[model samples]
Target: MILWFLGLMVVGLYLSFIMMRRSLKRSALIIVFGIGVVGSLLLITLNDNAHFGMVKRTTTNEQTIYTASPNVQMPMLLKQPAGTADKHAVYIYKTDPKKKAVHTKADLAVRNEISRTADTTASLTSQTTRWEYQNGFYGALFNHEGAGQFVSQRNQLAIPKDWFILTTTQAKRLSAKLKVLQHPTAQQKAALATKVKAKAAELVKAEPELATDQTTLMKQAQKAVQQQLIQQAVQDVQQHK
Candidate 1:
C-alpha cells in the first residue's frame, strides 16, 4: 500500500511539471512574435524618413532655385507698343544710361512693353527698378543729367534743324505710320499705293540729300538694301525657326 501511494504521488507531480513546461513554451513564442513585429515597423519608418530627407535636399540645392546675380550698371533699353489712340507705333529707348549695352532683361522688357504698354510704369516683381520706354530712342539722352547741352551740340549735323532735332513724339509717329500697312483697315488698303508714294516723299524730306559724296550715298544705299534683305531672311527664320 505504501509503495502504491508513493507511485501515485510521483505520477501526479510529473504530469503537473509537464503541463507547466508546455504553458511556458506557448507564452515565449507569443512574446518573440510581438517583438519581431515591432522591430519591422520601426525599420520601415526609418527608411521612409531617410528617403524623404534625400529628396528634399536634392530639390533645395538645384540650380533652378538659385538667384542669378543682378546687373545695375548695364546699358538697357525698353520698347513698348503704343495704344490705338496713339496709332499703335512701337516705342524704343534706353532705360539705363549708365549701362552702354542691353541685357537679357532689357530684351525681354522690350517685348513685354510692346504687348502690355506698361514698361515704364510697371513695377517688375523680379527686380525693383523704374524702367522708361518712351516714344523714341532713349539712349544717352534719358540719363544725360548734366550733359544735355553737350549732347545737343554734338548732334548738330548739316541736316535741317527740324530733322536734326527730331523728338521722341515724331519717332513714335513715324513707326506707327510704317506699321499701318501690316494689317490695314479698309481705308489703309484702299490708299496703300498713294500712301507708299507719300511715304517716299516724306522720307526724302525728313532725311534730305545730305552733303555727302555721291559714291558714299551709293555705298550707303547698297549697304542698307543688303541689311534689309538679311533682316528679312532672319525674320522669316525666326517666324518659322
Candidate 2:
C-alpha cells in the first residue's frame, strides 16, 4: 500500500515534468495530472480513516467486586443490557465502595462475557485492540487525525460462586420481594428459616469443607438462600428468555 501510494506520486510528477519540457499534447498533461489527483485522494482517505499503519494490541485489567449489603453478607453482581433485547450487554459494578456504580461501555466497539469462579473475589480482564501508528513517520502524518483510536475491546469477568448475578429489571423485583419477606409476619420468618437450613445442607453436601467452621457455614448458607431467591426473581422477570 505504501509503495503504491509513493510510486503514483513520484511517477506522475516525473512524467508530467518530462512532458512539459517536450511540449507534449494536452491529453498527455491531463493523464499525468489525473494520476497525481488519484494519488492525493488515496492519501486523504487513508489519513482520515487511520486504517493504515496501525497495530493491534491487547491489555488486561482487574477490578474487585463491590457488595452493597451491610455486612458483606449478600454479594450481588448486577448486569444491564444495552436495550430491551439481550444482544449487546454491559455490566454495572463498583470497584470502590465510596464511588458511584460504573457501567461498562455499550458502544459497538465493546463486548463483554462472564464466567463463574470459586474464589470470593470477582475480577474483570479486558483485551482492548486499538489503532496505533507503526512508527513516527505514520504518526507524524496521522497523529492529530486519530492515529491512535479505539477499535474494539472484549471484557471477561470471572465472578465468585457466592455472588448472585441479577439484571437491573430483576433487581427491582428482588427489592419488592425483600420488602414483603421482611414483614413481621410469623409465617414469612419461619419460611425463610427453613430455606436457609435447606440451602446450608445442600451446600455442605456439595463441598463438605464448609461444615468445619460454624460461622463461615452459616454465612455461606445465608448467601446461598438469598441467591436462590434472586434466581427465582430473575426467572420471573426475564421476558426475553
Best by lDDT: 2
Q: Model 2, residue 154: what's the lDDT? A: 87
Show the lowest summed lDDT stretch of 10 residues, model 2: 65-74
Residue 84 lDDT in model 2?
67
Of candidate 1, the 10-residue stretch with the lowest lDDT total is 58-67
lDDT of 2 by residue, 141-192 (tens): 5444564478888888888886767777766776677666556388867888
lDDT of 1 by residue, 48-110 (tens): 343211111111111111111121211112223355453333323323434342222322222
lDDT of each: 0.33, 0.71
lDDT of 1: 0.33
RMSD of each: 26.1, 6.5
Model 1 CA deviation exceeding 4 Å by range: 1-50, 55-204, 238-241
RMSD (CA, Å), candidate 2 to true, equals: 6.5
TM-score, one value per model: 0.22, 0.67
lDDT of 1 at 64: 10
